[model samples]
Target: MTVDVRLITESEYPDWLRAVHTGFLQPPVASDEEARSRRPYTDLARTRGAFEDGRCVATFRSFAQQITVVGGAALPADAITNVTVTPTHRRRGLLSRMMAADLAAAKERGDALATLIAAEYPIYGRYGFGPAAGVAEWTVDVPRTGLDRRWSRPESGRIDLVDGANVRKLGPDLHDRFRAVQPGAVGRDERWWATRTGAEQLPDHPWTEPFYAVYRSPAGEIDGLLVYTADDKWGDAKQPLNTATVLSLIAVSPAAERALWHYLCSVDWITTVKTGRRGPDDLLPLLLPDPRAARITLQADFLWVRLLDVVRALEARTYEAAGTLVLDVRDADGLSAGRYRLDATPAGATCAPTTESPDVTLDVRELGALYLGDASAVRLAALDRITEETTGAVARTEALFRTAVRPWCPDVF
Candidate 1:
């Protein structure tokens, strides 16, 4: 069957919404509610659908975003989302066609990279996206874990609970401040904030009725925030064991991080505090007297990055060490496939296409995994995803690509 692919029109948004939600196996949203929910941030110009027999069979969209790189630079990225195709449309080239079109458009518009939080690990690598970072899930036995007394408390910050409605007013500014310093964070527009705070004007949105809190400095400045929800469980022995699950937590400083974790553990009737999508190097372990009380229960890929322009993406971020390497990048899409020379110093980096022999040969996906400095070149080389053509080249590249902070993407979208 022939399928037509084109940009979705404004009049067809509800149908677009239903098509995507249905394809994902989610309950359909009420048309009236969706219409009432304003989505200026949705950018219909970037939304597309695959139509067969006058009905949408597949959907895709990419929002403009600023993704933080090493050294605190926010580079342009196309945040791909709402990717779905009906079950009947599976095995067709719909996914490939949509991804190629979206990526090509993003590249043509001068985006440095494209990013997504992959729902399934194996599907995106073929499209040249690599798992650039990993997040660790923590299940903290709160009762067994005591706050580290030796840890100096925040000088001026105080943690205070706030209502979900208050999050609408405070979350955006606090998040902006937090994102400025955190590598791998993506900018969240107003629409995203509205959705998180349940202020998006949509009725019965998914997620718990969020309990929000903020860490405020003595100077009355918000330094950190946590959004979470809890479910109370009763045991056969008549015990109240409630679980507090952290949906999102952003702390600007180490002090704030410690304070927020402590506060979460201290919540009344909470037997366990769980959080995920936090960087592997999260500080909760360091914040507790018994570090073992907080166990890493799960760890896996989080942010997947795809470089749209090899030279631009490589040159955009700050480097830590001085080195020169030639990379022969292979891309199935042929968008960023070529040999390029990268000269990186602690000061900055410069990259351009080169005709010289390559010191390393790898796929563009591996190159993207190395982009944020979370994936080590040596590791990828050992995994056979990357090749070091010369002796010590892997070591040299690894040293140069190391980031000061382990990159983590806290933002879901």
Candidate 2:
């Protein structure tokens, strides 16, 4: 059977949505109104649908976002999302065709890089996408005896508890201010914030009302805030459990972070607390009287990144350790294939197409692997994807690319 690929029209969006939603186990299906609302920010004109027998059988959406690249200038990036294919349409090269077309369109539109949250890890790697960021989920069992006495004695900052609805309204402004200076962070628009806070109806896991606690500085500035809820019965009923969960925590400074955690843990009648997302270098443990009370588990959560333009993506981010290096890159798709030389100094990295000697040769996927903290140059060399000329070239390259903190994505697109 012949399959036709074309842009989806507004009238045919519902059919396209149905096809993609069917592919999701717990699809966050959007209403016609919600989909329409998002059209302004997304590249809807490029959203492709594959039709079999004149019926939409597969769909994918691509949109542009402004990402803050570390050590280099921020640039416009393309994000591939809502990629889905009906089960029956699988293995027919439908997705391959759609991706090639979409990526070509992205390059033509001048996107430096492309990112996506992959539903399946193996599929996108062949398409030149590499894991870029990660989010770690944590569960902490706060013991009654483990509560720190220092945290129990609250200090001078005035804490005001407000309604969650009001907090939702305030989230966008706060997040915008926070992301401005935070490296490797993306801006969350009002609509994204609404969806995150559950102010608007989503497909699955409806938002639960959250309590907002705003911490004011001595000068009366809203320096920090936390959105959380309490669960009286988090542990076994026979054992009696008191747990408070932190849905989101934002603080402008280190002191604010300490004060916020202290306030949350000091809540009356709550013996235990848990936060699903915390930074790898989070200071919570440092503030704890006994570090053993806080348990941390690290799991690999992947975020894939694809460099659309080799020179542009490399020049976009800043490099910490200064070095001169050459990379021989192979692309599955013909767009980004070549040897590139990257020279780094305290100023920044200068990347360009080169025909000179290559210190290390690798595929585009290997490059993507190194772009995020997920995979190191040494590992890629061990896998035979990277050929290092010097004994420590891989190690030196890894040190140059290492970020201060592991890149993380707290929000799921």
Q: Which candidate number maximizes lDDT?
A: 1
Q: For residues 1-413, could you state the per-residue lDDT of candidate 1 as single tens digits?
A: 69988888887777778888887788855465665564555788889999898788888999888998887789999999999988888889898988988998999999999999999999999999999988898998877887642433455678788987778788888888877777788888777787777765455455557788888877778888888889979778988689999999998887778788877787777788888568888888877889898989999899999999888888878788999999999998899999999999877899999999989999999988989989988889989998888888888889888786888888787
TM-score of each prediction: 0.92, 0.88
lDDT score for residue 240 of model 1:
69
TM-score, cand. 1: 0.92
Give each model's whole-structure lDDT: 0.85, 0.73
Predicted structure 2: clash tally: 5
* Per-residue error (Å), model 1, residue 192: 2.2
Per-residue lDDT, model 2, residue 297, is 64
**TM-score of candidate 2 relative to the true fold:** 0.88
